[model samples]
Target chain A: MARVLTIGEPMGLMVATEPKALKDVTTFRRYVCGAEVNFAVGMSRLGHETAYISRVGNDPFGQHILDFLAEQHISTDYVTLDDVNRTGMQLKAKTLEGDPEVVNFRRFTAFSYMEPSVVDTVQWESYDHLHVTGIPPALSETCRETSIAMMKAAKAHGVQVSFDTNLRPALWPSEDVMRKNINYLASLADIVLPGLGEGKILTGFETPEEIADFYLKQGAKAVIVKLGTKGAYVKTTDETFYAPAYIVENVVDTVGAGDGFAVGTISGRLEGLSWSEAVRRGAAIGALQVQVESDNEGLPTLEQLVAYQNSAKLSE
Target chain B: MARVLTIGEPMGLMVATEPKALKDVTTFRRYVCGAEVNFAVGMSRLGHETAYISRVGNDPFGQHILDFLAEQHISTDYVTLDDVNRTGMQLKAKTLEGDPEVVNFRRFTAFSYMEPSVVDTVQWESYDHLHVTGIPPALSETCRETSIAMMKAAKAHGVQVSFDTNLRPALWPSEDVMRKNINYLASLADIVLPGLGEGKILTGFETPEEIADFYLKQGAKAVIVKLGTKGAYVKTTDETFYAPAYIVENVVDTVGAGDGFAVGTISGRLEGLSWSEAVRRGAAIGALQVQVESDNEGLPTLEQLVAYQNSAKLSE
Candidate 1:
């Protein structure tokens, strides 16, 4: 099993419990969520030894996130309890159709104030792979430095790195800065994962092939493009292929599909699967994730994945 | 001027910004509100020297409440910060009419877990009066004990006490227990304030006169029943009076109308106004409170109260 470390911010989420507008609804259910944490939980559920590294406030919400991570069997050795700022929070409105409206209140939060010194303390050599996202670097200058420090440390320790361009425009000062910083971090990873839409914005590439070639030319060994329901496109140097998406009757939520795709591709690669097989696993997991409500609840175990793959082939 | 001290749990309120349900709302505005805090703010704004006593989490929401109280000139001398528990919070829905729907998340909160020791530190003799609501004692056994202790301390020190039967049925274990405990606390006060509905439930009386006599027999010097838009009913030993509510073009919210009445009656009495004039002021303030959106925003200053009373009289 691969020992994976994922770094980013986890926030307390207040999701509307009904189908009414946020203003008209009176009930909310709390949950813990973050892109990197979601990826860690997905990887851990697939039998990978995953660790989550982040900082949270010394408050109840922070305690909740820590408890949730522990329950998911993700190591919390590198998590820090910061008293200077409160943990971040997000309020999600559950719409009848379309993506849920999310209002984030994370400015000057404990996670945004994370220091590079915290990153320097982690034992990078113990991890086989490291996963990072664009959200943390957009939080604050301190968080940006911490993200770079973590990526550089993992690279120095010979740990493979996976970078997801999960772009958030509102968190950063300017689009120029976001583009510059995210591109710099992408160049540091061995595997660069970006959705087709994010790839078009980040690389100014109109097609999947051009987008894959753009990231691969920038020191990345491979580029995987998430194409929503169509599937995932994997390109590694001289080879390129498409993995068709599994057919599902219902799509409960599509918020975490990309994260699930990343989990499948990274864990499959770690398990010595071929590039096309890894992309197929990514497509399968992405299809599964969209069928569930929460961000990471539908992630599959080893047996579930194998069964799902065989069933998909039989249906075809 | 009479120095007033009000005690209760202050919660961070997340209010939806639009007319949508809680599930469909994309934006929320944060505010610090609680019955006692609203009363304190009202009294302070009306030029009374007001102090507030409670426990809150050592978090940002708690900090916001403290800063807001300070800005309103309410003393925070007896406020305690607890690290072990989180501050209370409530999600309020915006309805087109009547009262709004509120979902409370206050279980095991810092204020609910407050110890009686915090109450013992307050210098009761320095304040001319103490104000409390039914919400705090219903929160937990510890809060109940603390409420009883503070009332007893105020009584022993010869400071007048105002008790508002701000009953929240969801906070109590049973209606019988709430009636028993709230009645016991009411007996310890010189002035008892109860809404017509709450009075009917607590005293088992159908009319304002019978309700006033019920509390008057329990050692209370005066009883005032809030009669909604109709006005206020006040009764003392041998005298009874009804003050008519002022007419307003719009009724923005009714959540804090009862608290506004308390502030008016108590502060008017402290200023040596006649019993009838105090009741009239209470009715006037109650009328004003229903014309604003926030809990205490419509609470008027001394000059504003005079102007409103004059305009109301001119209209009549």
Candidate 2:
């Protein structure tokens, strides 16, 4: 197992229990989730030492988040409770098929109140890997500056950095700023992950090869590309390959597929697996994620991952 | 001091800290508020033994409401926390003038989970007055039935019932249904209070005299009509008159003015004041409410109320 660190907001998620429009739905089941939250859960399930850093409101939602992270076996040592701001929350509609409609309440939340000083207390040298996402930087200018500071300090301390292009267009002030800042953050990481659809928007590149090459040229050691259900495209300095996607007949929900893939790829590399094997692991987890309703709930443990891959290979 | 009792929801109100549209504003100051909640605060401040009965979610907002009511010296012994439903919430935009843009998240809230069983537990006979609102009935059918049940039981136990036609058209299913139900609630009350604007819509009567008579013929002992800054109109079997409004130079938020008026009239009557004096006191409090930011923050204690009324008279 490797020691992993990530910085992001964990929001209180309220999912509708019935397959009705959110306006019509009255009852909702509460859960804790976010992109980095999903990533931490995946890493923990695969037997890694993981710690999360963020701020939540001093409210019940904050208490719930702390309790949830503890239950997931992820360290909350770096997490803090903020008094002036509220914890973020999301309301998602239940859908039988396709992506569920979501309404987010994250603006000016506790996580958005985070500043560059938050990075000052972290013991960066102790971690083997640092995972960062685009969402934090999109929250506010302070967060963007803080995110860059974290990656730079992690590098200064010899910790490996991974950046996920988790685009949140609504959070950004403008698309031009989003593209420029996102690419700069990507340039700071050893590994960069971008879904194919967002890759086109972020890089203005039409093909996966061009997109991966764009990031590779920006100083990243490897660029992993998500290709929806088709699989993933991988490119590194030494070699490049394509990993086939694990296919499921019915897709339950596609909200957390990319985070699952990131978990597999990051965990694999930490265990010293070759790029092909790691990408293959990522593809398998991404497939598993789309078959569940809530984000990260479908993520497999190390044993479950191996068994699932073996069953798929046998059927093929 | 009268033993005054009321049943209603106490909501978590988020008032924007800046003068901006709600969608544009991010910083909010939290406060506990609601129409009935405002009325209870006024009654409690006026030396009455006020008791509030309602359901709230087992969340931070619910805890805040509980703490707030307790601090206001209102009894919360009958309030219960519900695990499944959430406390209602309102998001109000900051405005320099006119009514603020408001967004409500009150449908299917914990208060709506109330049933006729709640009325069974209340010692209605021990109370001198039962203050009810039309807003509760508009929340949902269950709340409507429960409101009626409380009134019926209160009447059976000889508790004086004062119903406020606080018209909330959006909460009801249809205009026709809202009219019928609100009028029915008025007929069950010993005294009926309705804003002149709402009175015109609910009774199809253009003049306050006609509107008051509409309810008097339905068996009400008295009818009081709010006439905005122009004052209030009052009618009883023996007397009919208008209490001129205590004018305020610059009005603040008008959200809780009616509740403040109800507080004054009810408290005045409980202290054995005449109908004319009670209406005059109600008008003064209603004017005072529109001069402050929060709903009940401008409400004065018994001493302050007397001082304000006396000062206004001396100046006149």
Candidate 3:
């Protein structure tokens, strides 16, 4: 099995227990989640060796997240506790219509204080794949430097790099800065993934083909464009095609669909699948992810994925 | 020492950790507080036997509040756990410019479901005073009926009734309902306490004496109007006077000043202090309460109160 290492922030989520405005909600169920952590968890469940690195506060919420990661079998060798800054938290108001409304309380958190010294001592040679996201670099200037240090170390070790353009505009100083920094990171990744909406903003491209071409021209080996339920557009130096979606009968939540897709794509590649076949796996995982309430609950195991694929072929 | 029984909702409070807007804050320090509970806690600290009656959700926050009250030596004999509905919570954003912005998440909570049946079993005769507030009656139709039932039982037992017009306009269905219900409750109480602002809205009286006369005509034995740092105005059938405030150089928080005043007034009356002397005690507590950062942290014990009064005399 291939080993993948991801670095980002994990926040304590307080999800509303009922369908109401946040101001009217009195109860919440707590959970630990983040885009990169969700990706790592999805990979680990598929029998891949996954590791996560981040800083958490010396608080109960921090302890909870660490315990959750350990239970999920994600290695926490580089994880550390921060005494001065507390962990970040989010309040999500559950709704009957559309997506839930979320209020993020992540400013001045332990994750934002990540410094270059964190990655300087890491043994990058042990990890086969370095997975990163756009969020970490946007947290703070020091975190930006740390992200570059980690990516440069992975590159020096000749490891494959995968980057997800999970853009959060509120975390950045400006759209211009985010675009410049995200494009720089995407250029460094062998496989670059961006949602259709994020592509349009970052590359000024209106279509999936154009967006993929923009990233490919920047020296990326392949670019995959996420198109929600319509599926994904995959492009390499020599080929390009669209992967159709697996139609889900019930969509309970759509929070971590992209992370599931990333997990499938990365793991499928490590298992020696062709680029087009990997994109198909990504599409299937994304479809499965939206069928469950909790963010990453519907992410499939190896047996579950094979069973699901076989059933879909039979129905077809 | 006299016995005081208070019945109302207790809430889990999430106070922001720094000076910031509600949307910007990411950390909160949790506390348990309520209007009647605050009054009861204040009385309990003064060596009075205080009992609280309410319904709390069978949840961690509810349990925490119960444990906190027990630690403070307030009897929770009549408190029951609600199986279905959860306890209420409020988020307070810390600020340096003014009173913190608060958002209530108390709708459809256990306290709102308190019925007349809760009051039916209470031994109202054993209590020397029944402390109630305008807030509980405004929660739900059942709570309104419960408040009336409690006041009627206290009247039947010849127990002194202390009612605070702790106005929360948003909790009521309409202003008319709140005004009518509050006025009716005030007429039934031996002591009616209203802040100057609440009195203006409830009675449309321009001055404290006029406000006191309005309550006195409605069969109230005494009326006390809180006039902030200017002190309190007290009026009985035969006498009326203004108790000037003790000048405090620093005012950290003013959220629970009125609750402190009620505590001092109720306890002072129990201690056989004259009406004017009780009003002075009310003013002293109000002055002291605003000198601390926490909501009710500045509320003092009897010895502390005596020491404070002596110091104020020396300073003057």
The C-alpha interface RMSD of every prediction is 10.8, 14.7, 13.4
Runs in model 3 deviating more than 4 A are: A1-316, B313-316
Model 1 residue B36 lDDT score: 95
TM-score of chain A of each: 0.96, 0.97, 0.96
**Which residue ranges in model 2 land beyond 4 Å of their true spot?**
A1-316, B313-316
**TM-score: the better of candidates 1 and 2:** 1
How large is the C-alpha RMSD of every model relative to the true structure? 13.9, 17.9, 16.8
Docking class of 2: incorrect
Top model by TM-score, which number?
A: 1
In the range A279-298, model 3's lDDT, one tens digit per residue, is 77887887777776567778
Where's the lowest-lDDT run of ten residues in candidate 2 chain A? A21-30
Candidate numbers sorted by lDDT from highest down: 2, 1, 3
CA error at residue B54 for candidate 1, angstroms: 0.6
lDDT of 2 by residue, B108-177 (tens): 6788888889888887767999999998998878889999999999999999999999999977778999
Instruction: Report the candidate with higher lDDT, 1 versus 3.
Output: 1
DockQ of each: 0.04, 0.03, 0.03
Q: TM-score (chain B) for model 2?
A: 0.98
Model 3, residue A169: what's the lDDT?
90
Model 2, residue pairs in steric clash: B231-B245
